[model samples]
Target: MAIRPRTAALFAVILVVTLGVVGVIVHNATRSSTSSSGTVTWWLPDWDWDVATTLVRRFESENPSLHVEMVKTTGGTVANKVSVALDAGNTPDLITESIARTKTYIDKGQLADLTSLYDNAMPASDFAPGLTDVLSVDGKTYAVPYRWATNALIYNTDLFAKAGISGPPTTWPEFINDAKKLTTSTVAGTAWPMQGDPSDLTLRFLDFALQGGTTIKNGTPRFTRDSVEQALELIGTSVVEGYASKSSFELDNTGIRDLFLQGRIAMYLGGVFDADRAVGQKFPVGTAIAPGPSGPGVQEGVGWAYIVPKAAKNLDGAKKLASFLGRPENMASLTLTFPARVSAARDAKFRTDVRKAYGEQLSEHSIPAPNDPRWTAMIPFVHDTIQEVALGSKNPQQGAAAIMTEADKNLGPAQ
Candidate 1:
């Protein structure tokens, strides 16, 4: 099931209650020291559970002294689980989560500083340029980036042909016109994930915002800038005019992707992960950089990073597991995501037209999310304001102004 936004206050309360119960159990277990086996516990999301299990077995076979225990978590619950575990002083030695969310752990001083390991074992230069920086906080490394992805406009080639369109649109006006032409009684011209999940909605907004050169500097949002406002206006107009799917507000990424695979949507912004699935389903998928106000737009790239919490019971073993998973060979074998390591990314499997297109976009036009702890705090506000604009509850100008005000309050004064 898709995760929805929650108030920070509620999350804090859950964390406290969960930690109170777990802390005693952990403290008692550790104090007893009942077992001699050196087992490293890990919490990982369900996306690649099987692949991760295989890799963990291999690592254990290579190092008989260590046994890796994999704890499967879901996308919706993993963050809260990890938070409670950390507060209870019983967090898994290693965990995987989005780089953006991982930063919050680092901000709370809950993550291990992996600078020495990164320097001595996995050199920063071996990774995709700027990735180490993305995973770093205040110049200290805390996590190892595992896989990266950038958003792109994935379209149905068959739909384009039926609509008599030559190719994917490269400008906002063309995009809107093409979307209208692709619309039919049976299928939506385009789709957007307008579900209440802040991360989902905010990422979509950032794609357009970045293309317009919008940046959050010193906690002040630049949404009122002409370029940013224009981008929002385009999306607002498309939704209001019925060029986008009417059910967008109810659907998340997975729901939209299912519709795309069923040929119910002509176009949508998605990542490289969907490319293989589209091909596997025999859909004629065509990918292009997102269209901008006047030309090709910029996209944002982010990834999942592996981290060891500061409260982990098996620190050494955790670091070893992280290092093993980051090896070029293991990374290529286990993950379909674009590898964060430059050397692994060079593998022939990533050279396909779709992957190459995403790579080119990442190298040429992509930007990471704003490097600030409060960025996550601002997401829900941004999501809600965008929803208001898209659903016609607020005009684009009003939505932009409201977003700026909310951002200022949530993000605090510029550092």
Candidate 2:
């Protein structure tokens, strides 16, 4: 999560500001150069520079006929920039971005078909089941899900010991109870991120709602009133009951993590990386399966992927590179977290005590975040309502209704 984590804001800008508007065309597009036949242009996220460079070098050496020109793009800005380039029909041969972003392009027929290459390079059965679904629309693949992660319950063990708590919470009731027990003047029991990136806020809310039967399908939001209210109540009442810090109103995932490390809060529902963050730090950490109302909750698995544009200057070369990157070993190496391929994840790096909960949650209880074209537009409704509800300006009942109302306005009434 952070792969370093984000994009909701970026896509919102793309949908609202860049779509169908080819305003100022910069001479240099964040696009692959169409200068020559053997030059395969790739847009890489800055975080992946080193490892991706090594892989690119290897690719060039192995192929001998093709040279890769990697145009590195920073996170949070890449999506919007790429969207503008796409609107202008200026594209790189390959793009590295969140897999969910592919649906928007595929819907517009802007991506090349990768089904043959994907099957030949990495078979569907080798990946975690359903991982490739995000890259395909109507069973024709368009991208490769290269990286993935799921959330888990990350707790400060020292705090648990000091509070006389025996272990991590195993159920939702126990989770709230633990938060209550951990609360003190010095430390709030837990916290939820209520502000900052609206998309992150939406995902955090869904982290709980997913267990309550909330889902989005084909760009339409879906859930019963009880489930949405229950999800909001857990987040909102935690603050009202004094078991959660009010700082949550201002915190995002990074802010909440900082507070956890500083011991201002005892625990949080966080990404798999959060499970290992306390290593070499003052306090020890523990991870457990994030709990649901009854037991372990279903968490959302999210990550980056490789895509080839239909207008790619080197479509054949782009598909070749995508297939190469999608290989199990390469996928594992490229990902900072878990790879989409199940076989790739059998690598020792993914097998650790701290990451156990991630494995369980992902293999058993996780689902891909829905690929909704309207997700960018719908985030504000979720964000604003959750903030109002948590601050007591509105009750959970009203907050749930607002979300549905917004969803209907943006996505056409849940299909």
Candidate 3:
């Protein structure tokens, strides 16, 4: 499996920090009333330092009034660092973060409202459709998304044509039928990772829950819902019925991709980068939206966004930097994956055949994963139960029930 050993250790520390700190985030937090100097303290992740620093320089050159003091921060630990900083009233003016880590800040009212700043950057319609979802709460926006990506129905065009199938499936029935048609003695249709990092399994299952239109109750989607049962059966039965690959229980994302690249599988739901890897290979790759019970289904994916904290001393400088960075050209330069703006995605670098489906899905059919602190604690419970259901150790009904019972414990008294 491609699961990192260090991730478990990191999560152990984060779970402690997140659970203990989210409750009283604003209790000791002090807000900034008087504006400070023109220097903007921007905490940027180390992963993309080269591009980020260049952009910071560009922003400074364009706007001579504001100077950006770039601070190199680790993306994985920035959330914890920021939380401690907010507690000590030493907040930075700007930071780039994953939506999952940004949720706690947004929930505790520690983030500044970016709705007006976002609109000034670009119209709502101009941005990708479902990508804006996590950045907003109750009709208000708190972050500006620049980089985004999504899962798509990635298929081998040669296998589809050989099977006499015209295109990728758009409904549940068609999806199952296609899986059956694509499967052969030599090739399995698709595979899902059952035993790797729990977060990966949880996100994959959540994609199906979103696609099935599962009703989220009490601000959290319930495992006892009918849609959840359907999702489990749909995935579990496919492997059991021999339509999907039987090796799924042991395969992680990288393992599945290895099989696909070797022509052992026909199609699967995967990230845009999966198709990107298939380019110029032995066979052509085609990508489409994940099918719903009825029509196009929504898949959950993650993205990085720029957020301004409530206690930002240089608010004006942060706002100027955000607006400048949100421009289409700047967005294209910053993103390693698909940019959040449709216009930014129209850049020649992003218009390749493999990139088209991802852009469309991000624009029309994707949503951000539910960003709650408890979700991390709930991951293993959901992952282990889903694996049992898929392997026939328990039926869908029993699996769903088991997941909820274990999860509700970690979820605490609920919001």
Candidate 4:
């Protein structure tokens, strides 16, 4: 009507402000409705950041609406960082951590159940057998595994040739005999980690226990049957007979690996990564499955998985990313170790000699760590007992008894 200039000016200002408010409301509403079109924060170890970045880029290319924010964490500190975040109610959308830790989160109800996603995303038979057990608590899956690292016998081919050993040992008897043959004034036949690090000792012991047919029934460590005592006795005898170095009591896994690299240690049960490291250093290395009493022993390994926190703001986006990362090809590109998916290992890129060895051990002989939340807490007792046996303070029988008592006590009744 243009009755007054002041009135007209006031009306225009009101109209502009109202339109701005409406635009803000519409933007917020669109963002809420399209939950998949948002940023998903990911906390991953620094070592895997390169491959993770590549995977993220690919996912983003396919999902233009979603953005991934990669937060790199140091391996030693990531667990603590994740715990703090969870406690503070500030957890990221996704976390790539050891399966053991992931299980802990599941037990504490901190992570979302991915059982439905796992079932819908891939066929049950496509994954490595028993792979999901590590991330499951009370039969509900909480995470999806991507990469794995397992123990394998890494020997020096040059030293084996010098010792006149024809090939890697096929059984425990041969392993002991070969160790004796490989021992010299300069090099020890084989070395194992006997240091204060309970994890190293626990894993090494588990490899033997599993080979002896030890099983964890309802989260309890059962070592009385299946030649479990014989396995412990074998390790003890190796130490007492001087085939293995006494210094192993002071050395950790890394220390043992270093000795092997320097040609001072002839053989060792080490991670699959050791093969890659040896090859990288131009050292003549040979890989084999750990010898058991009867044949190839069950290998013990730990893996990393992708988990979404219960408090995640971008639940749908996080689930989408988790499923994307689980894709066989994507997982294969992320780690040198065996991929969790069977199809991923069948990819051409995993056909190298080292990868082949790892794949064989994982598929045929691998046993993941016990899916007990108390397993971590029980490592110290197991480690101490093994050290006691190795140092001649106790025999294998006594050591076994002590381990059972301690494990049972700490593990409680088991849920």
Model number with the top TM-score: 2
Error of 3 at 186 (Å): 3.8
Using TM-score as the measure, name the better of candidate 1 and candidate 4. 4
Q: lDDT of each model, Cα atoms only? A: 0.79, 0.82, 0.79, 0.81
For candidate 3, write residues 311-366 as lDDT tens digits.
99987788889888899999998888888888899898787877777777777777
Model 2 earns a TM-score of 0.89
Ranking by TM-score: 2, 4, 1, 3
Query: Residue 142 lDDT in model 4?
Result: 83
Model 2 C-alpha lDDT per residue in residues 176-224, reported as the tens digit of each score: 9999999999898999877677877778787778778777565345766
Off by over 4 Å in 4: 1-37, 119-121, 218-220, 225-228, 412-415
- Write the residue-wise lDDT of candidate 1 on 1-415 in tens digits: 6445677677888999899979988988885564424788888889879889889989999989888888899988987888788778777889988776776677688999888777555788887757777667677888988887788889999989988999999888898899999998888889888875667767778778766666644222344455546666876767888889888888898888999998899998888878778977778999888887788787766778889999888888899999999988777766676888777777888788767767777666666655465777777777877778888989888877776666557664323
Question: Could you tell me the lDDT of residue 47 within candidate 4?
Answer: 83
What lDDT score goes with residue 42 in model 3? 89
Q: Comparing candidate 2 with candidate 3, which one achieves the higher lDDT? A: 2
RMSD value for candidate 3: 14.3
Which residues of candidate 1, in runs, are more than 4 Å off? 1-37, 216-224, 370-373, 413-415
**lDDT by residue (tens digit), candidate 4, 18-51:** 9999999999998776764498999988888888
Model 2 bad stretches (over 4 Å): 1-35
